[model samples]
Target: MSDEKKLPLRTAFAVSVSKTAAALSRATGRGDGSVIGGRLGMMIDPDLLAHLAAGREIALVSGTNGKTTTTRFTAAALGVLGDVATNSFGANMPTGHTSALARAGATRYAVLEVDEHYLAQVIQATEPRVVALLNLSRDQLDRAKEVAMMADLWRQALAAHPKVHIVANADDPMVVYAAGAHPADEVTWFSAGQRWQDDSHVCPACGGHIQRGEAGGWACANGDLRRPSPQWTLLDGEVVAPDGVPHEVKLQLPGTVNLGNAATALAVAAKFGVNPIDAIPRLGSVASVAGRYAQVERDGRLVRLLLAKNPASWLEAFEMADVAPTLLAINARDPDGLDTSWLYDVDFSPLRGRQVLVSGDRAMDLAVRLEINGVPFTHVKTFADAVAAVPQGRLEVIANYTAFQDIRAELDRVL
Candidate 1:
């Protein structure tokens, strides 16, 4: 450890404290203390800063939604040219940085996906070269504060870096406005061009009117619109090379939202010089993003797990259901599914004719929400009861982060 580096005394001490804490968590099976991977960065911040000073470059992606898939796609797209590093597994915090650091180890280039709240904190400490702004939506209301609060924090993140490239989503008024003040080369707008229409109206930047175009892209009357020529375009439900290679991605988990996530991944990954067209074949190969649209099949029946961590995602997932399927919605303890306020924000009328099985720590709360909305559902306290309640048709299990794990455990038994 002494020969590791010429680390400052404070950094060395912090590293030791982090290592000890990590060890205790592992020994007690409480945690590796690296959920978001932040603690390790508290120690390694000095090292990451030194790397930046030495002229190394960094590519980072952060947003309220779609980070995991984007991170994975970015790494794959970039990995074509050289070795790449990323938090594809949701390790976007400091201790997660330690894990990333362990793998990246002089890889020279990195494309990391991080939490919106932690983005500014890490960018200030690490000074990454490119910061991809995917979009902002109402997600994780319990922990992330608000979408506007995140946008404000983003401005502070931009200030710390001399060179910041924002790959903004043209459909998101909030993201497009963040690009208006920045240079054209420094800012590029990405949109799916009619594939996905964002629900957010009103300009997050100017309080001006937002109008939708023929291709489903948005713009302001004052010319605050998605630029025509972007470094990357989220067009046609997948990423495409200008030559029409059709990075032909196919995500079987269902929903246009997964398609949107692919589009964002394509835009950011292309910027890092990965051939999007080549990666399309592999998107379907990733069957489950570990409960976030992850799929599992058992006993001649299939259970597609859609981790609806918030209202926006929940609504999108509900809209994505196919063939009038049976659904199971669970409310768990994670901040991902807390503050069911977003429940009232959505229209549950589509669920009127469908049978919904509700379960989780707060299953009664969600069940009540469904009842008030007149959506047909059965409330169950245990996963077994919920599984038994639903008929064995094409079952869609949409759970909050933690409940996803719970339902997935039972899926093994009854699917």
Candidate 2:
């Protein structure tokens, strides 16, 4: 329970204005209205987010990847207890948090998807009951902090808020280092496996080599930093809860990465006093978050949309996608980070035998990378072209941030 206070007159006015602006934005077909609404509200009252988060139980999910889906899962799992207000769309900054809280007035619980860079700021404002750290990796490096720097920010934030319980990944060294800032009892560890270890070869504590054990563990060669023993562990499609109870996880979302997210969500739900048995079923209820894994029918072909912003996420996307012809869209927009150089960081070898169709503003960059990786690809202009190039069947379309929105827009318009 939180000491939620009555909103001040000014803040109430700001909230009202924000909701109106967001509704108008949607009504006018400007956008989803989440960002516009929150921006207007925050402009009216700069401290609008803190003011709204004053009296509710908050859980924040932050990481380089999977934060959005993990936040969705945490919110759904929390549904077993009561209604949870969350930013269902990918608008995951201060403005988005303000809009979500303002829109869902009087909700007792909120599970927010906080951008990795803004994790500290959100923690300071919301004073969340539980902060779930999924995994720290290289993402949007041109706009965001480096992996170690982001981990340090998380460390400082957790240290400042000692009372906030932490549900963090033990497999990721950087996540372990950050979550270690909290005292033992205040932290809950989840052995959600990290598949992309490109950014965490060196220990964050010291520049020592991180030695990984075959039995799922890691330690710094010359420092005390090591993988924590997780209370909740994900084994072959099942989660073993803290009480040593094993519950099989069956999710509508694809891939083993989502299974790890399910484990992390269950851990966060447990901190809020939700039973894994009662909440596990709710986890299955979420088929997609935002438009990440949504399958839309275009030209009699079932096209699945998967978003991969960086190398780490691209790896997971490859695993989730089918072996059929795949469309890879890239963009260097502000939201997608103005660097396609990260494409070099992704191993495109998985699409070697499969048909790969490249599109978007950075299609040439993606094509060159695929060529270097010895993968064959055909360049296309639009989503319709990509669909036409393939036969009438399942086609997987993977894209970065803004390009994904573009395809989704075209998808809606064409349908």
Best candidate, lDDT = 2
Number of colliding residue pairs in each model:
12, 0
- For residues 212-326, write the lDDT of model 1, one tens digit per residue: 7665555766665444455445455656544655555677656767776676666666666666666565556665554566555544346566766766666767766764445
Error at 162, model 1, angstroms = 5.0
lDDT of 2 at 203: 88
Candidate 2 residue-wise lDDT, 1-415, digit = tens? 2233534776899999999998998899988788989999989778899999998999999988899999999999899888889998869999999999999998889999998888899999998999999998988888788899999988998899999999999999999999887889999999978888889989888889999888788999996798888899976678999888889988988998899899999999999999999998889988777888888887889999999999999999999888999999999999899988889888999888998999999999988898889999999999899999999899999999999989988877331
So what's the TM-score on candidate 1?
0.82
Q: Write down the lDDT that model 1 would get.
A: 0.63
Candidate 2 ranges with C-alpha deviation above 4 Å? 1-7, 413-415
In candidate 1, stretches whose alpha carbon ends up further than 4 angstroms from where it belongs are 1-5, 8-33, 36-57, 159-162, 193-200, 221-231, 234-238, 242-247, 298-300, 332-334, 408-415
Q: Relative to the true structure, how large is the alpha-carbon lDDT of every model?
A: 0.63, 0.90
